[model samples]
Target: MDVTGLIPDFGNLAFTIVAFVVALSIIVFIHEYGHYIVGRWTGIKADVFSIGIGPVLLKRMDKHGTQWQIAAFPVGGYVKFRGDANAASAGVDEGAIAGLTPEERRATMPGAPVWARALTVAAGPVFNFVLSVIIFFGMAYYQGIATDPLTVKQMAPISGVENTLEPGDEILSIAGLPTPELAEFGAYVETLPDESPLDYTVLRDGAEVTVTTLHPYPAFVGSVTPQTAAADAGLERGDLILAVNGARTATFEDLRAFVGAGDGEPLTLTINRGGEEMDVELTPRRMDLPLPDGGFETRWLIGIGGGLIFEPATRAPSVGEAFTGGVEHVRYIITSSLSGLWHMITGAISSCNLRGPIGIAETSGAAASQGVPDFIWFIAVLSTAVGLLNLFPIPVLDGGHLVFHAYEAVVGRPPSDRAMRVLLAAGLAVVLAIMVLGITNDLFCP
Candidate 1:
C-alpha cells in the first residue's frame, strides 16, 4: 500500500475544494444561524452554534455565551441548544437540566415550551426559504419585468414558413383566435393538439395582412453570442430585428438568410424594443458553425439565437410585483423539485438526477469559474435545494424534530428517551443510505 499516493494531487482539486467549502459554509452558517437566532428569540439558550462537524478549526464565544465555531468538515452544520446531548437536538441532558435553576432549565430544548421548540426548529427552513425569495426578488428587480403585446422579433429557420411572416409583424391573432397579448398567444399555441397550418393576422405597413403558415418557432431572441457582430451592434435578448436592409423579413430564417447573403457586407437593421424603433448598422462575420448532427457549415453571420414567438416588452416592476414574482419563483422550484422526485420514485424518470457531494462540489467549481454572479446564483439554487431536503419527514432532521414535537403536543408528553434514540438511529440509517445512493449514482451513472 502506497500511503504517499493516498494524498490527492492539488492544482484544480484545491480550487474545487475551496469553492465547495465556501459555498457550503455560507449555506450551513445561515441555516444554523436561523436556529440560533430563533432559539434566542424564544428564550432558548444555545450552547454551540457550529458550521460543519468534527474537530473545531475556529471558535468564538458571543456575549450571550453561545460558542460559534467553524469546524474541520465543510458539508453540514448544527446547533446544540443548552441541555441537549448532541447537535441533532435529539436527546436531552436530564441531569444537566435538574442541576440548573427553574429559569435556566426553561432555556434548554426539552424544558422549553412546546411551541417555542417547534418554532425554533421550524425557523431554519423558513429562513432558507426567505433567503431564496429575497435573492429571487433582487434578481427579478434587476432583470426588469416582461410586459407585452406580442411583436415578432425573429423567426425559426424552417423553409416553407420563412416567407410568410415578417420580423416587425405584430401578431394580432392566430388560428382564428384573437391573441391581444403575448401570454394569451403562447397559451393558445401550447394547447394545440398538433402542428397545423394556421392563419396569422399581423399588422404591417400600416395595414392588417393575413398569411397562412405553420408557426414553427417564436420570434423572441433566445440568445446573443458574445464578441459577435450582433453583440457589437447591441442586439440583445428581446430586441426585435424588425427589418433587414430596409426590407421586411418575417421569420428567424429570413434574418439568417439576409445575414448569410450579406457575405461580410454591412447591413442596416431596424430594431424594435418595447415599442421603440431604431436603426443599427452591422457587418456580418464569416464563420464556421458546427451542426448538431455533425460537421460544420461556413456562413456569414451576426451571432444571435431566436426562439419564443412574441417579444414581450420589459419595464421596471413595482416592489409588490417583485415580491410576488419572488414567491412564485420559489413555489415553482419547490413544485418542480417535488414533481421530479415523484417521477423518479415512480420510475417515470431516471434516478440519476440525484447528486452527491462530489457532484455538488464540481458544480460549485464550474459556477465559480464562470463568474461571481453565476456562482451566487448557483449558491441560491443550492440553498433552496438544501432547505427543501431538510424539510423531509425523516428522522434526525429539523422536520423530524418537529414531528416529534407535534406528537408530544398531542399526547401531552414526549416519547420515551429510548424510543427517541431508536427513531434517530433509523433516521440516520435512512439519511446515510440516501447519501450512498447519491454518490453511487454520481460515480456510475452516465
Candidate 2:
C-alpha cells in the first residue's frame, strides 16, 4: 500500500496531539497546584507533586521536601501526600505512618483532620474554576463592552452592497424605525425589513443625515464554531452566504430560515468569500441549544454565528462590571453543561454529545488553528469542563473523596480500609466505563 497519502493525516494528528497536550497540561498543573498549596497551608505535607502520569522524566526536591516532577504521560497529574499509598491517595502507607513521630504524622494526609482533608480535596476544582474566571475577565476587559447610542466604529465589507455609513456616525433609525438601546439592538434589528439598501438616519458631524445602506443584519458569517458542520465544510469567518440552494438570501435570518426548513437535509450554500463565489454542501446538525431562561430548544444548525454589518463602538467597562460578566459567563457554561448532561440522560438529546478524548483533541487543534485568542478561550472552556468533571460524586475522584470526608464527619470515623478499597475500585470502574462510552460515541456516532 502507498504510504505517501497518509503523511498529511499523520501531520494533522501530530498537531492535534500537541495542542491537546498543551491545553491539558496547563489545566492539570493549576489543578494539582491547588491541592499542593492548600495541603501545605493546612499542615499536610506532600511527598510528590507530579504533572502527568507514568515514569518520571524530570524531578526536583523543594526545601519543603516535596518532590516536584514531570512524568511521561501528558494526560493527567496528581499530588501524592505523605502517608498516601498511591497517587490517588486511596489509602494510608501504614509502614510510613508507623515510622513517623506523632508531630510528623500530623502533617500526613491520613493524619490530618477531616476538615483540612476535605478542603485540600476540594481546592483542585475550585482553582480550575478560578482560572476560567480570570481568563474570561481578562478577555472581556481587553475587548471592552459595546458603547451606548450604538455608534458605528467600523463598517464591514459586504459583497454586492455599498455601505455609506462611516465610523463615528451614531445610528438613530433604520428604514424610519427608531433604533433602541444597545442591549436591545439584536431584537430591534430582527424587526427591520429583510430587504437591503435600507435608509439609515445617522448623526454625522453634529448633523442628522439620511443615507442608504445594506440591511444592518445581512447574511454574513462573523464566527464559525469548531467541529461543526460549517467547520467540517471548511467555512471561515467573513464568508457571506449569498444564496441557499439557489435561493437568494438577504439577511442572516433568511439563511437560518432556510436551514430550519431543510429539516437536517444537505444544503447547497453559495458563498461569497472576498468577492469570489463558490458553492459548498453540508448537512445541518440537530443541536439542543440553551436559551436565556435556562431551557433548551432543538434546532437545525450549521454552527456559524452572525452579526451586524458594522462594528459597534465600545467603551471600557469598570472592573466590577467585567468581573461580574466573567462570573456570569462561567455560570452560564456550567448550567448549560449540566442541562445538556441531564438531557442526554433522559434521552431528550443525542448521547453522541458526550465527546471523548479524540473529539476534544480535534477541537483543540481546530481552535488553535483559528488563532491565539480562540485557542485561549477554548482552554478556559475545557478547564471549566475538567473542573466540573472532577467534582462529580464518583469514587476515585475529588468529589468521591469529599463525600468520604463528609461520611467521616458524620460517623466520627473513616470507612473501613476494605470498604475504602472496594469503593475506590468501583469508582475507577465507573470512570473507565465513561471513558469507554465517550470513545464509542466518537468512533460510531455521526
Candidate 3:
C-alpha cells in the first residue's frame, strides 16, 4: 500500500508496524488502567502491573512498591495479585512476606476484597470498549465537521453503498442505527450478511428512495503472494469487481467462496468499469495453498483485480452530529460483536473465522493499507469485540470472576479450590480450542 502523495519516499511496512505499536500501547494502557485504578480504589494493593507477556525489557519500582515494567511483547498486559498458585515464580513471596514486619512484608494480590478483584478484572475489558468509543467519536466528529460531495463522484471506490448513493441521498440510518461519518458507512456494509437482504434508504432529488443492492466482494485480498491467478490475469490495482456471474458481491469473502466453488471454470464477472458494470470472464487458475501444518493444497482463483475505494465527500458532518454518530457506531459494534459471539457459540455461523493474534495482525496490516482512518476503525471494532468477549462467563475471564462474586454474595464465601481448579482447567481447554480454531481459520478458511 503506497501513499501516492504524502509518503512517496517512505515504506508502508514501517508505518504499519509503528502505527500498530502506538495503537496497541494506547489500548492496552486503557484496559490495564481500568484494573489499576479500580484495585487501588477498592482497597487492594497491586504490587506490579505490566502490559504484554513473556520477557520483560525494562522495569522500575515506584516509592509505593509498585513495579512499573515494559515487556518485550506489547499485545496485552496484566496486574499480578498478591497470591494465587505461586508467589516466588512471579517475583513475590506471599508466605515469606507474611512473616515479615508490616514494612518488610510484601502485599499480595489475593488478599483484596472479592468484589475488588472482580471489578479489577472487569475494568480492563470495559476500558477497551471505552477507548473504542472515544476513537470512534473522534473520527465521526472529524467527518461531520468536513463536507464531502455526498455523491458517487467523490465517494471511495470501495464504498460498497455510498459510491452508488446519490448526492441528495438522505443518509437516514444504517442497520437500523444512524451515523454521520462516511467511514461508518463502510462499517455498516462490512457487518451486513452476504446472502441476506442488503437494504438502505436514500433521498434522491428530495424523495426518499430505497436502494437495496447485493454486496459485491469475493474474499480477503492482500499483498505478499508468491504467485497467484490474479497476478497472471493482469489484474491491476484499484480494479474492484462489482459482481461475479451477475450476482452482486458485497464482501471479498462472498466472491472468493463463489470462485472457489467453480473449480477453475470460466465465470462471468461484472466489474465497476469507469463507474459502470462491464462484463468480463474470470477463469480461476489453481494454486497450492500452504497449510498451517506444512501440507499444501490447490485452490481455484480467477485472474481478476478488485479493491476498496472511498470517495472524498463534499459535505462533512457537524460536530454534534458526529459525536452522536460515534456513540451509535460504538454501541452498534458492541451489540453486533455480542450477537456474532452468540452465533459462533450456537453454530449459526462457521467458527472457522474465529481468529487469534495472527488474524489480528493480518487484519491490522490490511486495514493499514486501506488508510489510517481504516486502521483506526479496525482497532475500535476489535476493541469492542475484546471487551464483549471478556464478558463471557468462563473461568479465568472477567465474567467468570463476576459469576464467582455473585455466588459469594449468595453463599458468603468463594468456591472450593478443587472446584476452582477444575473450572480453570476447563476454561484453559476452551481457550486453547479457540486458538486452534483461530489458526485454522487464518490458514484454511480466510
Best TM-score among the predictions, by candidate number: 2
Model 2: weakest 10-residue lDDT segment is 1-10
Residue-level lDDT of model 1, residues 68-141, one tens digit each, is 89888777899999999878887877777887888888889888999999999988988888888888888877
- Residue 85, model 2: lDDT of 93
Which candidate wins on lDDT?
Answer: 2
Enumerate residue pairs that collide in model 1: 155-252, 165-250, 166-250, 167-249, 167-250, 218-308, 218-309, 219-308, 219-309
Instruction: Assess candidate 1 and give its TM-score to the true structure.
Output: 0.66
Of 1 and 3, the candidate ranking higher by lDDT: 1
lDDT of 3: 0.61
The root-mean-square deviation over C-alpha atoms between each candidate and the true structure, in angstroms, is 12.1, 2.5, 10.6
lDDT of candidates 1 onward, in order: 0.76, 0.89, 0.61
Q: Write the per-residue lDDT of candidate 2 for residues 1-446, one digit (tens) a residue.
A: 33232223887878888999999999999999999999999999999999999999999999999999999999999999999999999998999899788899999999999999999999999999999999999898777889888899887766654358889999999999999998898888878998876999999999999989778888888888976899888888888888999999988889999999999999999999878999999999988888787667889999999888888899888999989987887888899999889988898888888988978888898888888989999998998998899999998999999999999999999999999989999999999999999877766665
lDDT of candidate 1 at residue 395, scale 0 to 100: 84
- Misplaced by over 4 Å in model 1 are 1-12, 148-313
